[model samples]
Every structure is written in C-alpha cells, then in structure tokens.
Target: MYIDLHNHYLPAVDDGVLKIEETLLGLKLAIKEKVSTICFTPHIWSGRYNNSPEKLKEVFEKVKEEAKDIKIKLFLGSEVYYSSTIAEDFSKGLYLPLGEKKKFLLVEFASAVMPQGVSDGLYKLMLEGCEPIIAHPERYSYVQKDYECLFDFAKAQIPMQVTTQAIMGMLGRRAHRTAVKLLDEGLVSFIASDAHSPEERPLLFREAVRFLNRRYGYQTAKRLAIDNPKRILEGKSLLPVAGRKGKYSPFQ
Candidate 1:
C-alpha cells in the first residue's frame, strides 16, 4: 500500500481545497489512483494559518467518516513550519504534536530562499526525537539552482518527499527536472499528490507510478511509492549516506 505522508487535504485549511465537495472529490481521485493510505496534512504553523490539534482532529474525523466506504485509510497530520520552538513544542513535555504523534513533522521551507541554520535546527529537532521530513524539495528554487544542497539534506539522513505534481510537470520545468533527477538518483523518499483540491490540483499517483515504473522498473517505483513511505509513516530512522549516482537496489 502506498502512503502519502505529505499533502494539503483539509478543506479551507491553508492553501488546500476550499469546500467539502472539492475535498471529497480530490479524495475520490486518490482512491481511484489506488493510493491505499493518505495522511491528511493541513498546515499548522504560527504564521497565517494555524490549525490547532483539536481542530485538526475534528476535521479529520469528519472527513474520515465521510470517506469511510471509500477503501482508503485516512490519517491526520500537520504540515508544520519548522520553527525555532519546534523542538520544545513537539515534545511530550511541551507543546502540541502533529503528524504521527509528532514523531514526524512535515517541514516546509521558505520558497525562494533555503534559510540558514536549518541543518543545525534539524539536528536540534532530532535530538528532541522528532523526525524532520522536508516537503517538496523539487519545487524549491534553491534546490533547482544547486542539487547538492538537497544531497546535503539527504546525507544528513533527512527523508525528502517529492510532490506528484512536480513529477507531472505541474509546477514547471525546473521543478519537473529536479523531481526527475531526485527520482533517478534515489533522493526522493515518498511521492504525494500535495493536492489542494480537485479543481486546483488533482491526484495523479497512478500515472506518476506508471511513468516511474516505465523508466526505472516496478521495484524502483515500489521503493518510492510504498516501502520508503511505510518507513516514514512508522517513524523509522533514515539511512545514513545519500542518494547514489548510479542505481538504488530496491528497499534495501
């Protein structure tokens, strides 16, 4: 079963789907794609949109109840903005937890700039026992400029998720190329729709999986689509080292 650990599925939550109808429509597409499990990651940060834990749980419960007969397992999480207070706030002794009991935090970076002190802050979060999963590295301009920065993140043992839309060239050429490059080099740890809504952004896991299978074979697709995603959902520690230059032996 494929698990999408990063997504903006909650309605009127952040930049995702606006209404309940659109949210359900997006989910229906996900079901058709055969994506067995999906983590509903609404934005939870201090800035503009701050969805509290209670609110998040309530919304997820509502959505899950609505999608009960769809054969897709729904889970709740937050696309957390990795802030300075993340470590303190994420821990059991402190603030609210998001995403798999807060073991995994969907961290998003500034769009244009790949801020300084991120790696150090990541190390601190790790020390606090929180797994930092960077969302959509392929869409980052800095990543487009220098792939090695991503390589550095990968080497730091941070699992990076690739948005399905990026692979589909929905984000544009640079993002598409970066997405492909990451896939070829085994830098991508998971593939998610990042679907805001059915109208705005749609689910294309099946087509993306087909393309990936066609290019890299079935097992490779399974690694990115299934195994690695499972590992992330389970909060498994990432492997040391980085994406290979040649080929990755599937799910080793």
Candidate 2:
C-alpha cells in the first residue's frame, strides 16, 4: 500500500483526467497498482490553469462523490507553478497543500529556465510554515545542469519528489538519468506516480516499487514508496537517506 503524493486524476480541473469516466478509469488503475491513497494534484499556475483553493475543493468534492464507491482514498492538492508571489498568495489561502495537515506543498518550476528568486521564494514559503516539495526536479533543464542545487535544497530540509515514470525510463534519457542520479545520491525523498490519465500516465507504483526493491533493496524502496509519504501525510519529518556509491546498488 503506497500513498501517491502527486497525481492528476481529478476530472476537468487541469491537464489530468478530462471526464468522469477517465477519472474512474485512472482510480481503477491506481487501485490495481496497490495505491491505497492518492493525492489529486492538479496544476495551479498563475495565468495558466488558475485553480483557486475554493474552486479546487468544489471540483474535488464532485470527483470524490463520483468515485465514492471505489476502495482507494482520495485527497486534494495542487502542483503549484512557482513564482515570486507564491508565498504571498499562499498566505492569502490561494492554494491547497498535499493533505489536510497542510504541512507540505508540491511545487514545480518552468522547464526551460529556473526562476531568479526560486530559492528565496521557497524560503518564504518555509517561513510561512509550509515545507515545499519540489516536483520532478530532474525534468527541469536548470536542475539537470546543476544538480548540486538540489543537494542544497535537500540540505535545507526541503524534499524533492521524482516521478515514477522518470525512473522507469518512460520520460526518455535525460529524465531517467537524472532520476537515477538523484536516487543513487540519496537526494530524492519521495517517488510518486504523477499519473494524469489511465492510458497515458497510468499508475506504475507496483512496478516502481518492485524495481526499487530489486535494484536498491526493500528499505530504500519502501521508504520512497510508502514510509516517507505516510510521514508527509501525518505532518512529520522525514528520515534522511544515505547516499550509495554505485548506481542502483542494493542497500548494504
């Protein structure tokens, strides 16, 4: 049983499941993959997909009602696009956190260029008592160029979440390489299925967990897939991961 901290299964909210049928299909796939808990993190960009907290709650309720009979649990959050004003907007209650506790916020940066005030922006959020979890940092070209910046974020106790498909090589070579490097270096805190649709970005929790176990041992796999995410939901601090020497070597 894994808790998926990042997913886009809510119907018609963002770039996720477009209709109710698609939402149900995505939930079914998640359940099949042993994902007991899922966080519906639709995109919340400033001028693009501008989803407010109240609006998201209404949409979440509708989707929740539609999938009420499904055994899997549902949650509401936003994969917020990072901007200098994010902290200010969050202060005004413009966004939703990963869970009810509101301890962690899932954030993403632009793919081409890293924002100038990115670090300061995240710091401001932290000052407001919200831990920012950088989503798919490996996918960002800036991060790919200077991964040590990721280490800096991790050192500051800000967590980084990598998508499962990236590790599985479904997102191509650069993403796959970065994901592996981050995992091997122990910079990643959570491994989540950023599933959008049933067919396109289906939940691969079972496969991801199995691969992590086989390549990195049960401890590392379990921590990324289950333990750490559970802690995040519970509003607790995560344990640090020790970096391994060789690539994908089993934990000693």
Candidate 3:
C-alpha cells in the first residue's frame, strides 16, 4: 500500500484544497493514483492556526468520515513551518513527537534564505527524540545554492522529502538537477507530492517512481516509493543514506 506522507487536502483551511469540493477532488486523485493512505498535512505554521491536538483529531475524524468510501485512510498531522516564530516551543510544538501515528515530524522551512540556525533548531528537535523530515528539500533555494547543506542535514541524520514536481523538473531546472544529485548521492529519504490543490500540486508518485526506476533502477526507487515511506507511517527508525560520490565541499 502506497502512503503519501505529505499533502494539504483537508479543505477550506490553508492555502490548499480550498473547499470540500476541492478536498474530495484531491482525495479522488489520490485514490486514482493508487495511494491507499494519505496524511492530511495542512499548514501549521507558527500561530497561524492555534489548532490544538484535540482540534486536529476532530478534523481528522470528520475528514475520514467524509472520505470513508474513498477507501483511503487519512492520518492526523500538520505541515509545520520551521521559523523563529515557534523557535522557543518548536522542539515540542512544531515537532509532533509523541503518539503511535508517527514519531517523525514533517517541517517546512522558510525558503533558501531562511533565518539563521534553522538547522540548529531542527537538530535540537531531533535530539529531543523526534526525527525531522524536511518538506520539499529540493525546492529550497538554499539547498540548490549549496548541495552540501542537504548533506549537513543528512549528517544530522534527519530524513528529507523531495517533491515529485521538483524531480519531474516541473518546479524548474535547478531543483530538478539538485534532486537528481541528491538521489544519486543516496541522500534522499522520501519522495512526496507536497500537493496542495487538486490541479496545481496533484499526486505525482507514480510518475516519480517510474522516473526513479528508469534512472536509478528499481531497488532505489522502491526505497523511496515503498520502503522509507512505510517506515514513516509506522514511526520506525529511519536509516541513514550514503552521500553522493566525489569528495566535495557542502558550500560549493
């Protein structure tokens, strides 16, 4: 069963899945894509939405009830923004550390030029027991600026998710190139659509897996599409990956 770890299909809340109609459309798209499980990760950036864990559960139940016939098991989680706004409580707040759903926390950083020490905060969160899965590492201009920053995060041993669009080169050439580089280096841990709307960021796993199989072979592709993602859903220990060949500086 394919499980999509990141998506914004909760409806009428964040910038994604703006209404119930869009939410259902995204769900159907996921079903059509053959994804049996999907985590509804709406934006939990800073105080933008002070939704408590209880509130999250409430919405998850409602969405699941609505999507019952679709046969997709919806999960409870948030796509938290990694910024200074929650710097103090981030270790506890942004990173959803407890519960059996998943010990891994999915976090999205500000962009290439994010505030300094962003990595440090995530590192701290990791030390506190939650593994941080960086959302859309390929889209981060900072990662493109220096492919080594990703290695640095990898060195911290945190798993990173690459957007299917980035790998498809749909987001742009640089992101595509970097994604390829990361995959070649064996640094990528997961591949997700990070899908927002039904049209703009629709499911791209099948296309992504096909590309990975053609370029990197099936074993590597399976690791991204099948293995690592399964570990996330089960909250298991995420294994580390080898860096790309060639002695290179991370800043270069």
| TM-score of decoy 3 | 0.88
| Residue-wise C-alpha lDDT for candidate 1, range 1-252, written one tens digit per residue | 666776777778788887777778877787778888888888876767867888777877888788777777777877877676676677633333333555767788887988778888788888988778898888889989887887667666677888888888889999999988887777776788787777678778888888788877776778778887776666665432124344752432
Among all windows of 10 consecutive residues in model 2, the one with the lowest summed lDDT is 243-252
Residues 1-252 of candidate 2 have per-residue lDDT tens digits of 999999888888888889989988888878889999988899999888988888989988988998999998888888999989989988999889987787999999989898888889999999999999999988998777878767557667788899999989998899988888888888888899888888999878888888778777778888899999988888898866544543332221
lDDT of 3 at 243: 36
| Candidate with maximal TM-score | 2
* Count of residue pairs whose backbone atoms collide, per candidate: 0, 0, 3
Per-candidate RMSD, Å = 3.0, 2.7, 3.4
Q: In lDDT terms, which candidate is top? A: 2
Better of 2 and 3 by TM-score: 2
lDDT of all predictions, in order shown? 0.75, 0.85, 0.74
Error of 2 at 108 (Å): 0.3
For residue 78, model 3's alpha carbon misses the true position, in angstroms, by: 1.1
Return the TM-score for each candidate structure.
Answer: 0.89, 0.95, 0.88
